[model samples]
Structure formats: C-alpha cells, structure tokens
Target: MTRQLVAATKALLVLTLVCGVGYPGAVLLVAQLVPGRAAGQPVLVDGREVGSHLLGQPAGGPGWFQGRPSASDASGELSGGSNLGPSNPDLAAVVADRAASLRAANPDAAAAIPPDALTASASGLDPDISPAYALWQVPRIAKVRGLDESAVRRIVAAHVEDAPLGMLGQPRVNVLALNVALDARTAGEE
Candidate 1:
C-alpha cells in the first residue's frame, strides 16, 4: 500500500509540473515570438489605438460599412458562433431580420444581400467582411458621408486585400481598416 501511494504521488507531481507549469510556459514563449498577432493586431490612428484589425466591432450607422453579425457581440473574450445550424428556425428568423434591417438602411443599394452580412461568422469576432458586402453598403455610406458613389467604390476597391497565397481564403477587407481609411478621407474633405 505504501509503495503504491508513493508511486501515485510521484506521478501526480510530475504531471502537474508538466501540464500546469511547463506547458503554459512554452505557450507563452511561442506567443511572445509573434507579438503583434498575439496582441490582436491593433489598428492605430494618429498613433492612438482605435481598434483591432483582428476583432470585429459594431460600427453601425449609414456612414459606415458594417461587419458581420456577431453572435458574441464582437467580444473577443467571449468569441464563438451561435452554433445555430442553417435549418434552425431561430437562425432563420435572425437572418430574415438582418436582411430587413439591411434593406431599410440601404434602400438605395442595388446589390443582393451578401451571406456574410446575414450569418454570424464561426468565430463571431471575425474582423472582416466580404468585398461584396462592403460594396453592397457603398451606396449608403456614400450617401450619408456625402461622398461620390464612385469615390466610395474606389476606396473599397483599394482596400480589398488579396487572398493569402492567391488561394487560401477569399479576398477580404478588414472592417476597422476600411473604416479608418474612410475616416481619413472624410477628414481630408473637412
């Protein structure tokens, strides 16, 4: 009995040290190697932090192009999808409501509602919206900001980041980056 107890205690101590201390320490070291990414890739304006390009935020209003609906309310700490499947009536209802709101906000917009605009992304904190979605909101943003439609379109076009390695993911625009660029353009006009 004594021998078994001693062996069990020894195994417990070793596992605790490895899992609770060594594993965490190693993870911390690796995260330090990529500080900016691990720090959420903060977006800066005039040297002051405005937001992060890595996390989506609620930037509603006709003057701005919005990001995807966030099931987590864009909270990085609580980031996750709603886990509602496509066939779920609750999800369907939310999508319908989102579509209605989009139509009301952008009555002048001619583009069909983009899927990203209706469904919350899996991470719920995704910082980007599809170019289609961004362009779809161009008319409304232009009208509200009192800028020409072509100018808003040009800005959106300029910010369209190419897919990684030309194939990995879809072309995307960071909502915070796009909004910051818009702000800069708007400031230039003032």
Candidate 2:
C-alpha cells in the first residue's frame, strides 16, 4: 500500500509540472513569437492605437457602417452575449427596437434588414459583420460621406475578407477596417 501511494504521488507531481507549468510556459513563448498578436493586433490610425482588430467599437453615426448590436455595448471588460434564447420576450423586444431604428436610419436601404443587423453576435466583441449586413448600410454611408453609392460599395467590396482557408466560415467585413478605408477614401477625394 505504501509503495502504491508513493507512486501515485510521484505521478501527480509530474503531471502537474508538465501539464500545468510547462504547457502554459510553452504556449506563452509560442504566442510571443507572432508579431502583434500578443497585444490583440491593434488597429492604428495616424500612428496612434485606435482599437484592437479583434474587438468592436460603438458606431459613430449613420455615416459609418455598424456591426451587430453589442450586448455588452462593446465594453471590453464586460464581453459576453445577452444569454437570451430565441423567443425570449426580452430578446424579441430588443430585436424589434433595433429593427425599427435600422429602418429609420436607413430608409433608402432596400434590402431586408439582415439578421446580423438586429442580433448581437455570440461574442459581444465580434469585430466583423456579414457582407450582407455591411452592404445594407451602404446607401446611408454613401449619402452621409457625400460619395456615390457605387464608390462606397466598392470600398466595402475591397475590404471584404474571405473565410479562412476558404471553408472555415462565411465571408465577413471587419467594421473597423471598412470605416478606416472609407475615411481614407473620403480624405483623398477632398
């Protein structure tokens, strides 16, 4: 019995050191090897950090394309979904309100409001929106930015990112990248 207990103790210590300490240390080392990844791959403007490409920010106005409704209101510290299932009354009411607002803001947008426009992503911090959702806001963006709708659509088109390796997920537009491109295009036109 004593011999068995000694062997078990040794196994426990070995597993703890290898799985707990060594694995995490190796992970940190591997992560640090990537450029800008350890810091969330910051999005920069004018040499200043604007935000992280992995996180969402509040929409500026009708001129800017919006991402999904952020359940935590895009708060990095409170990143989470609303936790409300479909058919939950509270969720329904919120979606209704969001739909109404989208209609009011985008009266010229002929497409049906995309699901992404009314619903928050599973991660409240999702930085990307479906291509459909981004295009739906094009008319409003074009009008507000004083660019032709086709020009704004082209900018959105240029920024669309294909799914990873061509199969992992659907195409998406990173809202920050899209808005930055819009600002750059607008500045150049002036």
Candidate 3:
C-alpha cells in the first residue's frame, strides 16, 4: 500500500508540473511573440484605444457599419449564442424585428438583408460581418457621413478580409476596422 501511494504521489506531481506549469508557460511565451493578438488585437484611433478587433461592438451611428446581432449584447466577457432552434417562435420574432429595424435604418438597401445581419454568431462575439451585409449599409452610411457613396463603397471593398485558408470560410469585413477607417477618412476631409 505504501509503495503504491508513493508511486502515485510522484506521478501526480510530475504530471502537474509538466501539464499545468510547463505547458502553459510555453504557450504564454509563444503567444507573447505575436504582437497585439495576445492583448486581444485592440482597434485604435488617433492613438487612443476604441475597441477590440476580435469582439463585436456597437457601430456608434448610421454612419458606421454594424456587425452581427450579438447574444451577449456585444459584451465580450459573456459570450454565447441565443441557442434558439430554427422552429422556435421567439427566434423568428427576433429575426423579424431585427430585419424591420435594419430596413428602417437603411431604406435604400433594396437587396435582401443578409442572414448574418439578423442572427447572432455562435460565439456571440464575431467582429466581422458578411461583405454583402456591409455593402447593404453603404447608402445609409454615405448619407449620414455626407460622403460620396462610391467612396464609402471603396472603403468597404478595401476592408473585406478573405477567410482563413482561402476556402475554409466565407469572406468577412471587420466592423471595427472598417469603422475606424471611415472615421479616419472623414477626419481627413476636415
């Protein structure tokens, strides 16, 4: 019994030191080598931090591009989806309401609203939106910012980031980055 207990204790200590301490330390060292990402890739404006590029946030006003509807109210710490099934009535109602609001805001968007606009991402923290959705808001943003529609479209086009591995996922535009660029452009015109 004593021999077995000693052996088990030794094994536990060794495993804990390697798996818990050594592994995590190595990972932290590796993560630190990559700049900005370890700190959540914050989006800055005029040297001031505005928000994280990796998380969803309100786009401020009609002049800014909006991201997907977030289940956590755009709070990064409380990440989760609504988890409502397709047949759920509440989900349908919420989507309908969101679509209505979007139409009201962007009356010139004649195209069908993209699904990502009405539905929150599975992680409730997606910072990107479909390119179609970003384009849909061009008219409203241009009108609100008093900028030409073509200029706004150009900004959107420039910010469209390709998916990882090229074919792994759909292309998306980061709302925070796009908005920051919009702000910079508008500021430059002043």
Candidate 4:
C-alpha cells in the first residue's frame, strides 16, 4: 500500500507540473510569436482597443456590423447557450421577433431570411456570421452610414474568410473586425 501511494503521488506531481505549467507556458510562447493572432487577436480602431475576435458584442446602431447572438452576460465573461430546444415556444417567439425586425430594417432584401440571422448560436458568443447573413444587412447598414451599398458590400466581401483548409466549414465574417473597418473608413471620410 505504501509503495503504491508513493508512486501515485510522484506521478500526480509530475503530470501536474508538465500539464499545468509546461503546457501553458509553451502555448503562451507560441501564441506570442504568431502574427495577427497574438494577445487574443484584439480588434482595434484608431489606435484604441475595441473588442476581441473570440467574443461577441452588441452592435446596437444600424451603421455598425452586428455579430451573432451572444449567450454571454453583458460583461462577456460568463458564456453559455440559450439551451432552448427547437420546440421551445420562447425560442420561436424570439426568432420571430428578430425576423420581423430584420425585415423591417431591410425591406429591399428577400423575404426569405437566412437561418443564422434568426437563430441564436450554440454558444451565443460567436463573433462570426455567415457571409450571406452579413450581406443581408448591407443595405440597411449602407443606408444608416450614408455610404453606397456596393462599397459596404465590397468590404464585407473582402472580410469573408474561407473554410478551414478550403472545405471544413462555411464562410464567415468576423463581426468585430468588419465593424472596426467600417468605423475606420467612416472616420477617414469625415
């Protein structure tokens, strides 16, 4: 029994040091060396920090590019999903309301809306949206920004990221990055 206990204790200490200390240090070192991905990939504007690529934030104004639904609290530290099943009445109501608002805001868009625009993301903290979802809001965003719709659409197109290694995932646009670009362009124009 004593031999077994000593062996277990030694194994635990070694594993803990290796995983808890060495692994994290190596990861941090590598992250620091990467370009465009260091320090949490913070989104900045006019030399000021705005948000992060990993988190979603509310874009209340029409001129700003909106992110996916956030399941996080206002502070964005506690992340979670709505956990409402598809058949939940509350989920249906919320989706309906969001669809109505999108329609009202973009009367020129097609009546059929994208699912991403209406449905909450699993984590509710997704910072990206489908390229189609971003395009759907272009007309409304252009109108609010007093910019040409084509120009705004072009920016969205430029920001559209292809799937991982070409085909693993759908195209997505990081909302915070797009919005920051929008603000920078608008500021430059002014």
In candidate 2, list every pair of residues with a backbone clash: none
* lDDT (Cα, tens digit) per residue for candidate 1, span 45-128: 989999988888989667987999998898889899999987899998989999999899899988789999999999988989
**How many Å off is the CA of 74 in candidate 1?**
1.5
User: Judged by TM-score, which candidate is best?
Assistant: 3
> By summed lDDT, which 10 consecutive residues of candidate 2 come out lowest?
30-39
In model 1, which runs have C-alpha deviations exceeding 4 angstroms?
none
- Tens-place lDDT per residue, model 4, 1-190, is 9999999999999999999999998988888788567666787666888888877778868778777665564245667778889989999998888888888878877647888888777777788999988988888888888899898998899999999999998999999889888887788779
lDDT (tens digit, per residue) of candidate 2 on 74-149: 9989989999999799999999999999999999999899999999988799999999999999999999989999
Whole-model lDDT values for every prediction: 0.91, 0.92, 0.92, 0.83
Which TM-score value belongs to model 2?
A: 0.87
Using all chains and alpha carbons, the TM-scores for the candidates as numbered come to: 0.90, 0.87, 0.92, 0.83
Candidate 1's TM-score reads: 0.90
Enumerate residue pairs that collide in model 1. Answer: none
Question: Against the true structure, candidate 4 has what lDDT?
Answer: 0.83
Poorly placed runs, candidate 3 (over 4 Å): 1-5
- Give the number of colliding residue pairs in candidate 3: 0
